[model samples]
Target: MAEILLPLLVLCPLAASLLVFLSAGRMGARAIGTVACAGVGISAVASIILSVMLLSGPVAGGLQVTLWPWMRVAGLSADIAFTLDRISMVMVLVVTIVGLLIHVYAAGYMRDDPGIARFFGCMTLFVAAMLVLVLASDLLCLFIGWEGVGLCSYLLIGFWYDDPANTAAARKAFYMTRMGDVALLCGLLLLACATGSLRIGTVLASVADGRLPASGVNVAAAFILVGALAKSAQIPFQAWLPDAMAGPTPTSALIHAATMVAAGVYLIARVHDLFAMAAPVMALTAVLGALTLLMGACTALVQSDLKRILAWSTISQLGYMFLVLGCGVWQAALFHLMTHAFFKALLFLTAGAVIMRAGHEQDIFRLGGLRRAMPGLTAAFVAGASALAGLPLVTAGFYSKEMILSGVWHVHFGLAREWTLSGHPLWGIALLGAFLTALYIFRCVFIVFCGKAGTRAAGRTSRLMGIPLVCLSVLSLFGGVIEMPDTLPSLHLFSALLNPGTPLSHADEPVWLVLAGALAPLAGLGVAWVLWGRPSPVMREIPGQAGVIRPARTGRGMDVLYDRVFVQPFRLLAWLTRLDIPGHAITGTGRLTRAANAGILGARAGLLEMLAIRATGTARWAGHLPGLFQNGRVRWYAAWIAGGLCAGLAMAVLS
Candidate 1:
């Protein structure tokens, strides 16, 4: 029964997307919403049932179901397979249950949209793709889902195509992610070449057996890290996410919560075995994670836009996941991933509701004193904000974050005889991030919800919108009790469920470490209270704050840097490539013409002119061939890829 149902986890929503897309204008908004919700809702329910089944069965090894044979050639074979292990179980539950809630909310949020059906279709498709990405046992097969989510992101982010900003954001995300995806593909190919199989277990076995050289392991792991970093929107790749806010709020929520941005962390966690052998790469990952964690927290602090703030917050939280991952605590990385999903989703949805009521106002400063106008929303927002700040003892984020902090403190990476990657330094970065996380989130809360009502909010919260917020809020508040540090009762339910026999808390962990982790958020809350709790105009207009917000909001000019450094240069190269051949041919013709006029070919000048014209025309026709890949049409590019794949396969079979 479990085998029969596993594929449906991805298929349900995929089918819904297809059905809704095919029906198109034939279906009304309500019908479309029903279809979308039913697809994800069924998957969510099945995920719970499967979780029950998994709890009773072998969790470490998991149950596998092969849906179909994908390919076989060149000493390699792949299958369209799914695995329902503890890690995947967590991911499935988060993707489906949280996805279902987001879909339901979106149905209400986008009820009046002319493109509601299209929106739901793309969203359902995205859920299906995310499910595939998590469940696949083969790395090559996983790429299908990986690319699936990227394409869906491009579609959903640009769903409101009339808005130039929205389309640009979508393109930016697509191009930036592709940069990482290319590296990811290279890594997968390297693995396949070395191990003769792309199965997750097989590749790991190859690494353990020393079939793959140390250098190969390091290079492959580095490529995978690049991909994950870009996908999760870490420092260098972090700018795309804030701009991603041009999409609708539900899109933002889904992407931030689980479907898209978190994909990178999940991938790294999945391939931890291989990463473990690449110690230098692992240290690099940890260092990068710390840098990203600090950068995201600082950038998020100065953002005025409501959704952008959350976007940057997502980047920062994901940084913690990577930090633990780099520190070789993949389980802890995943633990935080689950809790972060609950509260972050809660926050995004609550922000959506507030934005809708406030006449689409998104600037936190503009939305003054909303706490009085919409107390329910204010309460919901506060719950999420508290979780975001990881308020000690009460919030799910606190436990998950505590697990992460403890993990960071316990990391034992030795860089050299006298030097090592100490947990204390990274721990310090994470603790500082904690402080900023609380301060910034609470700052938004106190500013937007506490001050006198300046923005006149309209309409009431629909049941659809209110329900997800309420459910997620409850989870955000009480979800942490399942896991606690030694200083507390030492609940280990979450750790046990994730990996049985794994200790809930580190043995003999210093007491002050946990105390410091607890105090950081409290200190942040205190600072936020001192700054914005009283709701004075003077407090709102803090001197020298603009200087910080300006650079931070612009991602410290990373966007401009990208435009100047990468984008402009790429555009120039593509432009040159497109004309390089024909331009040279024409220039040669001009040179010849001048020479002919100089009497070198005076008697045959007419024939020379004819020859020059013919040459120019022929060169123009030939020039486009060199630049076909440079043209920005996706369909044409895909066709090129298809043709290349066919040729490669033919050569392989023939050889």
Candidate 2:
């Protein structure tokens, strides 16, 4: 049953995407949505059944389904396979279930749009690809799905092709993520070279048994870490996500909350065994995650656009997941991933409805007193905000966050005596991020929903939209009860479910840490109420000091840095190519070739003349060989590839 269901999970959506493309606008929006929803519904059901079966069996049980032999090359045996263990089980549930809800919400959100068919096609394809990412047992096979989602995201982000900015944003996202993808492919090759296979289990086992040397482990881990960093939008790679909001709101929700950004954390958690052995890489991850957390939280505090606020918040929350994963508490990372999915989805969807009702206006300052115009949306927004803020006892975010905070408190990382890091400072950074998370998110909520009707609004959310909000709201508030701390019931159900035999024990939490973690959110709420809950003018001060808001809003100039370092040089090379200099050089070579042939034919005096003509012809022919590969239009693309190869070689030589 599990075997049949496992393959069916990916096939269902794949078939539906094909149907959507085949239908080709002949079917109405209703029919297209029905097809997409039904496909996702089947997948969600399959996920439930497969999860039940995995849990019901022995402690180490999982379902590994192999479809066929993918390849056999130079001692490598790779298969197209899927694995449903506890970690992937959690990922499968989130991608399928939350994805299904988002699809349903999108059906209503996009009903009036003319490109509904194309939208559903790319969206369903996105879900299918994400499922492939989480479930694959082979690392190389997972890259297929990894690139698959990148393609779908590009298509969906530019779904409204009429807008030039939308297409540019799509291109920007594609180019930035491609950098990480290249590094990831390199890491995969490194592992394959070390272990002679790309199977996840084989790689982990080999690395654990010391089959790979220590330096090999460190290099592989560093490469994979860079990949995850760009994908998850941490620190240096955080610029693209805010611009990614050029897509539709539902697209924003799906990508930010349930799927693409979460892929990085899932990949890290999936291969945590490798990270545990590389202490320096782990410390680097922790430091970067903490930096990104503070950066994202601070940026969100100053944004006026509602969607951009959520966008920055996603960056911050993912930082927490990265933080916990770096600290060797991947289960806690995943727990927050789940809870973050629920609340983040809820918040994005509700914000979409709010924007729709307020005449497509997204600025929270321009939208006020929605508490009167749309009461239900106000309540839903509050529910999501409470969870995002991690307000005590009832909200799921608090428990998951506390789980992470606890893990951070106990973690220690260092490679040698000269380079050591305690969890205390990073934990402090995380707690500060937590406080800013509460302050910024609730600031949006209060300004948008608490004031008197400042902007006109009409047309409440439809039943289709409301249903997902209601379901997610409940999940956002109650999901963390399944995993409690030592002071509580000591419920290790979440951890226990992941690794059946090793339930974590945590009875000795420090008083100050526990007390501070619980209070940070509440204190932030109090500050927000003092600042935003009343009729006060908007403040421009960033966290810790007075600073320029524009820089924070633009991800603290990371974009400018990248543009200077990466984009400008490439643009210069492109402009030089578009000038057609290569084409002219090729034409000159053709002229030289013809002249040399003429000289050769004309040479008939003696052996000396013949030898000179032959020598000249050989030189001309060799020069002409260079022109054979010049395509004339934009050699920039070819140059990029050649440059990449050169860089790779340089790196090899340097190493």
Candidate 3:
């Protein structure tokens, strides 16, 4: 039953996408939206059922259902299999539930667009691909889904093909992720070569049992880490994600925030043993995550665009997840992944409503005083923003983020025997990141929702858009209750369901760390209040100075550096290949061919004229000989006739 049902989770959306695509020209927007929503909704239901069953049943090794024999070679074999474990169950639920909600929201969001059917089609396919990726039992199968998501992202990101900027953004995202995909593929190949199989379970088991060497695991893990970093939009590869905001807002919600950006974290968590085997790589992951967290937080602080602000926030949040994973807390990282998905999706969806209400204006400075007109949206935005800001005890982000910080604190202090006052450097950096997260998110909220109404009139939101916001807003606020820290005895539902054996108790946590965690967001909120919450002359004038905000707006010169170093050089090479090399070769070949043809034609004409002249000369000479033979007309004729007759007779006698 699980076997048949699990594949349906992947197949339903795929079939819906196909149906939508095939009937695109024939169907209206309403019909297309129905098909897309129904498909994802059904998958969400199935995911719920699977989650229930897996939770009730024995889920250690998981319930593996082999659909077919995918491949077979000398010492290698793989199957199109699905694994329903605790981790996968959480991922699938988040994907399908949030995916279905976004699809519903998009139905209203994109109703007026002519290309709504195409948008829904690509969106549905994207969900299916992610489902396939999460449920896949083998590395090869996962890679197929991996590339599938990449393809779908490109299609959806550039759905408005008329816009060159959107297309460019899509291409940038595709190429950047492809670089990581290549690394992932290399890692997969290395794992296959080392273990003689591409089955993820087999590889993990081998690594756990010490069947594979540490060196090989380290190399493979390093390659996979690069791939994960690129996919997750961490650090250098992160420039594409902010630009990806060129896509529709719903796209920003579903792919960029909720599912796709988190795939790298999922991949790392999924193959954690490989990382654990390589101590150096694990440490590097921690450092990278810490660096990205600070970078994202700092950049997000000064962004005026609402979506770009959230985009940078996502990068920063993902860094926290990676930081936890690197610190050897996979479950904590996943917990953060779940909570972040709920709130971030809510945030983006609400931003979409805000943008629509503002007549498609995305600049936070321009969007002001909508709290009264659209109370529901304003409340929803506050909920998401509060969660994002990690406001005290009420929001989901606070709990999840605290867990990661706790984990980091433990790893840092637990390792050293000395009870020094100096905490881990990452802990301090992470604390600062938390402060910035609170400050930036609230800064946008206060600027956009709290101030005087700007020029744009507030547009009405449809129930389709309003309902998802309401639902997600509720989740964002109360979702933290599920994974309450061990200090609280009543609620450990998420921890128990996800990690039954290992209880994360806070009693042993350092008191100073807890104090910092509790105070960081408050401090940030206080700072933001002073900066944006209260009307100030400085706030008004700061927007005009390009020098003051340009660095943060441009991702602190990372984009400039990338364009100068990577994009420009690549463009030059591409120009040479596309135009210079081919153009010159074609022109040179045409010139040489024309010159040779001209010489050949000239030679032929000269030779023909010379032959004609020679023929005329021979004719003239023959005529002169006949004249010489006949001095007088009669005498010449008689001599020629006699000579001809004598020659004929002599020839006949000789014969």
The number of the candidate with the highest TM-score is: 1
| lDDT of each residue in 1-655, candidate 1, tens digit only | 9887898888899999999999999999999999999999999998998888989886466878998999999889999999888888889999998899899999999999999989999999999999999999999889999999999999988989999989989999999999999999999999999999999999999999999998999999999988998888886888888888888899998975656888999899888899999999899888888898888888788888888889889989999999999999888888888888889999999999999999999988888888778999999999999998999988989988999999999888976677876788899999999999998999899889987777999999999888989999998899778888888877788878876986556869888988999999999999988888864534774446566567777664788888899889999999988989778999999999898777756668878899999999999989977786687899998998999999999999999
What residue runs in model 3 are displaced by over 4 Å at the alpha carbon? 59-61, 412-423, 541-549, 571-655
> What is the C-alpha local distance difference test score of each model?
0.89, 0.89, 0.87
In candidate 2, how many Å is residue 615 off?
36
TM-score of each: 0.88, 0.87, 0.85
lDDT tens digits, residue span 529-574, model 3: 8888886613632464487468778664777888898889999999
TM-score of 3: 0.85
**Clashes found in each candidate (C-alpha, N, C closer than 3 A):** 0, 1, 0
Worst 10 residues of 3 by lDDT: 413-422
Better of 1 and 3 by lDDT: 1
On residues 263-381, what C-alpha lDDT tens digit does candidate 2 reach at each position? 99999999999999998888888889998899899889888889999999999999999998889999999999999999999999999999998999998878888998888988888
**Backbone collision tally, model 3:** 0
lDDT of 3 at 267: 91
Q: After aligning candidate 2 to the native by TM-score, how far in Å is the CA of 293 from where it should be?
A: 0.5
Off by over 4 Å in 2: 417-419, 535-547, 554-556, 575-655
Better of 1 and 2 by TM-score: 1
Q: Which residue pairs overlap in candidate 2's backbone?
A: 369-451
Question: Would you give me the overall lDDT of model 2?
Answer: 0.89
